[model samples]
Target: MMISLEYIYRYPIKGFPGERLEDARLNLAEGIVGDRKIGVGSGAMAVNQSGEWTPCQAFQRMTIRPDLTTFQVDRHDHILTLTAPSGRSETIDADTKQVEAGNPTVGDQLPVYRANGNKGYWDHPDAALSIINLSTVDAISQVIGQTIDPLRFRANIYIRAKPWSEFQWLGSQLSLGEAELDVIRPIDRCKTTSVNVKTGVADLNMPALLVRHFGHLYCGVYASVKKSGTIVPGASVKITGKSEDRIIEAAANAITAPALPDWPRPMRVSRTVEEATDIRSIWLEDPLAKTGSLSNFKAGQYIRIHNLAQTHTWRSYTVSAVDGSRLRITVKRDAGVGSQAMHSFNVGDNLTVSGPFGEATLSGKSKAHHFLTAGIGITPTVAKLRYLYAQGFVGKVRVTHVARTASELALWDDVVDAAKRLSGSSLELHLTKNVGDTVGAKLGRPDPSKLAEYAKSDKADVHICGPTTFVNSVMAALGSIDFDEEKIFLDTFSSPSVETEMRPIPASEPIRVTLQKSDITENWTPADGTLLDFAEARGVVISSNCRAGLCKSCSCKILSGSATRLVGEEGNDRRQTLVCSSIPSESIILEV
Candidate 1:
C-alpha cells in the first residue's frame, strides 16, 4: 500500500544541504534520532534573501560543509573540518568559512551543532518526529491553488490511502506501531518556507499561501519526542486515536471501496445550539457505536466533522454537554464550504464520535490553571465551561467570551448557569465589545496582559477555537505573557487551500529498477503508468510508501545513466528516483 525507501536522505546542515543514502537504518524508538543529527548552525539561519544570504534568528547556516554528505566533526575550537561530498576535504572555521565562501555570518561566533552531539557522522533517529500525507498535501494544495513541497513541513513519515480526499488533521492519535509519540500540536508556519528549502532564497508570497490555505505556516504535525523503534519504508500505518465522533470515518469509509478497518473515529454533532443566527448546538453520537459508554470524556475536548465533497468540508467544534450518553457540540455556520455543510445535518443522524482526544482535556494530567477564550459563537467555549463547572474540581479557571455585541454573545446565560451550578470553583467570564476590555479589542489583536487575564490565571491551560486570526491573536498574546506552551490548545479548523494542477509529464523514457543480486528488473512505461503499478502487476516486491517523493519510499540509488528526479544527497549525480511515480530517461539500470 506504500512505497519502500530504497535509500534515505540525511541533511547534516539544517538548511544548507543534504546527502543521499543507499542504506540507512531507522531508530523509530527514538524520534528523529539520526535525521538532521549534525547541523552546522551559524549564530543565525539566513535564507538567501534577495539573492544574498540573510541572517536568521539563531545563527548563520552552513551547508554539509562543502559538498560532504558524510562528515567527521572535530569541534575543539570554533573551527570545523569536513570531508565533503565532493570528496574534496576542507576545514571550516567559523570566521574563515563565512569570509572565504562569501557566506554571510550574523555574529562573529556561531554555534556549530553536532548530530546526537557527535563530532562524527553516525546513526540516530530523525532529529524530530514528522509525518506527511502525500494525498493530504495534494488536497491542501488544491485549496490554496499552489504547489507545496511536502518537504517544507519536514516530516519523517508519509501516509497514503488516507480515509479522506482532504488533508486530515489529528482526529485521533496515530499508532506508528513501532514507536510511541506525544504529538505536541500543529506547527504554525514561518517565513522560512518563503525561502526555498534547496535554494535558500526567500519567496515572500510562498509563505502567504500557507496562511491563506493552511490557516497557518505549519503544514507538518509537531510531535513530542517519545518512544523510538525501527521504521522500515513501506510499513503499514494504523490510526488509533479516539474521536469526538466517527463522521470522518463514515464519510471517508463510504468512499473507500475495500474498507480500511483502522480509520480513526469520527466526530459527531452533540446537542444542537442556536448560539448565533448561523450557528447551532451539536450532539456527539458515539465513537464506536455501542462499543462503550461516552462518559470517558473530560471538559474542553473538541471534535471535527468530515464533510466530503459537500458544502461543509470539515469543522472542529467544542463539546457542550459533559455526560457520556450525550455530549454537546457547538458550531457557527460561517459562510464557508465546511460550515455550510454542517448546517444541513439533523437529529437521529448516525454520526460517529471518536475522542476523548486532545492533551488539554481539562483533566488531572495537567495540574495547571485553565483559560478558555470563547469568541463569536462561543459554543465550544461554553461546553467546556459547563463541564469544568460540573466537575467542581478545585482549581483556578478563567473564561473570556468576546463578541461584537451583547446580543451576539452566544450562550452566556448557559455559561452563567454552569458557573452557578458548579459553585465554589474559580470561574469568571469577561466580555468586551471594544479594545480596552475583553480578550483584546473586539477587532484588535490579543496581547500579553489581555491574554494573561485568561492564560496567566494560576498556570492556566489555554484552549482557543476560532478562525485563523482569532487563534493566532490568542497564541501571540499568550506567548508575550510566557504562558506555558504545553497548556495551550488550539482548534484551528483544517482547511484545504490549493487545488492540484496538471504537472508536466515525467520523463518520456521508461524507468528501470533492477535488483542486482535478484536480477529482477522492473520496467514502467508512461503508457503503463508508474513503476509501482508495473511492479505490482509483475509481483515484484520492493518497499514503497508515499507515492510522491514526500516519503523516502521508492528512493533508488544510481548505478548508471543520468536519471531525471529531484536532487538529493551530497555528491548525488542525479541517479536515484522515487519509482512510485517517477518515469526515467532512455535506458537506465536500477537495483529493485
Candidate 2:
C-alpha cells in the first residue's frame, strides 16, 4: 500500500517538549536543523556540559518526569517558547548558552541545566532521525485496548503505512520530497515512550508491550539523511530498491569482465600449515605484490576465495593472519564442496580472492575488549589479537576460545603468544568434551559469571564470532546478566536456517512469476522449487552468491504481488525479497 508522510515534529531541547512543523529542512550532516540542538540535564542526571557527548541516560528524560511532556514548545528561528499546562509561558533564545524557564523547578524540585552542542543531541550517534508508522502505533493501540497517540513515540517523522511496513524499509533508501534518507536500523523502544504527552503521566508501557507482541523491543526506525532537502507534512514517501541491490548494481556497472582489482584478485598459495586435525591455514600472496597492487584489509575482516583452476568453487573464510604482502585464511574441513576443495589446496596453487569485508573489529575507544569464539570462529580473533599485539594495546583484553577438543583449537600457540606479548591480555581455552584442567584451560564452555567478571567495567565492547548456536547461546547468557546488548557485537559464520522444512507447493495450483523489468513471465509450482531455481532454469541470469542467504547478493525488489518467505525469516517484505528462499504466494512481479 502507498504511504505518505502525515506529520513532522522537532524537539529543540531533548526531553523537554516537541515543536510541530509544517515543513522542515533536513541536512545531510546535521539532520533536521534546530532539532535537539540542546539537551536538559538535572541534578540527578550528570552530564559534562563542556565535554564530548554522553549517553541519553545522563540527561533529564520524560520517563523520570512525565510533566516535561505536558509543556508545549514552539520554535521560530532562534527563539523558542515553552508553555506549561498552567498557561505559564517562557521564551528563550536557542542560541543562548543557558535557557531560563517560567517554573525553575520542573518536577520534584529538579533544576534543569541547558547543555548545548554543535551537532544534534541524539540517543545514538548514528540515529539522527527517527520514523514511526502510524499504522504500527494504531495496531499497538488495538492490542493494548486504547488509542495510542503518535506523539508518544517522539519520532521526527510520522507516516501512514501498513502495520510494521516501516521495517521493510530497513537497509533501503526513502525519498521524501527532495530528501533521501538511508534507513539504517530499527530503533529499540525505551521507558521514555511510556510517558503520556497530554496528561504528563507514565501510563503506557511501550517497551513491555512491544516485547510481548513483537518478540523484540523495537518500535520505530532510525535513518540518516543522505540528501539535503525540505520535507513537509503530507509529502509523498517512496522507497527505492534494497541497499544490497543498489550496491550490486553499482559494482556490476563499474567493473568489467575477466578481472578487476577490487572485484577479485589473482593470488598464489605460498604456504600451507595444518592448524589442527581438520583445520588448515593457507597463506596467499598477490602475484603483483611487488607493484603494490594488492588490496590491504582490516584485521577482523574475511575474504571470499575461489579456486582459479576450479572456477565453480568459492567460499568465504575469515582472515587468520596478515604479514607484509601476504594474507592467511584458516579453513575447517566440512562436507561442503568449497571446504573440501580448500582442504585439498597445496602450496603454489592459484586462487582468486575478494574483499576484506566485515565491521566487527576492535574499537580504538574501548578500554576493555572481550573476544569470544568457538571452533574455527577463532580465525578472525587471531587476526584481531595479532593486530592488538602490534599496536601494543594496554587495554584489559580477554579471549575465551572454545573447541570440541584441545586438538581442535586452531592457532592456539599464536593466540597464547600474542596474549603474552600484550599487557593486561589473557587467553583461556575451553574444551567442550574434555574435563581436564590444563593450565589456563577450562573444562566446559564459557561461564556467564566469568564473562561478567571480565566485562564488569565501563568502556567495554564485546566481540563474538562463532557458529549460530554458539553465538546465540553466549548472547543469551550475556543478556541474562544485564549486559547491554548494544555493547555486544556478533559475526556468525552461518545464517539461521530459513525454515526447518520447505513446505510442498501444490502442483494443481501453479503460481505466475513475472519479471517486470525483463518483461518475462513464467509459471511455477512448489515442485519447480525456489524463485531463484526457476529463474536459473529459464536462463534468466541473476547475480547470486552464497545461496544460503548469509550474503544478500540475490536480494531483488518486489515490484508487485506477494510472496511467502521461508518460515521464521523476515524477507517477506513487498519491497525486497530474497529469491533463494522465497516462494510465490500469488501472481508475483519482480524487478530483477
In order, candidate lDDTs are: 0.46, 0.69
Q: What range of 10 consecutive residues in model 2 has the weakest lDDT sum? A: 251-260
The most accurate candidate by TM-score is 2
Model 1 segments beyond 4 Å from truth?
1-8, 31-33, 44-111, 117-127, 161-185, 205-208, 222-232, 240-279, 283-327, 331-336, 343-592
Worst 10 residues of 1 by lDDT: 118-127
Per-residue alpha-carbon lDDT of model 2 for 225-331, expressed as tens digits?
77899999888999875454443233223321111223444467899999898999999985434333334456777776643222234466788877877888898
For every candidate, C-alpha RMSD to the true structure in Å: 21.2, 22.7
Alpha-carbon RMSD, candidate 2: 22.7
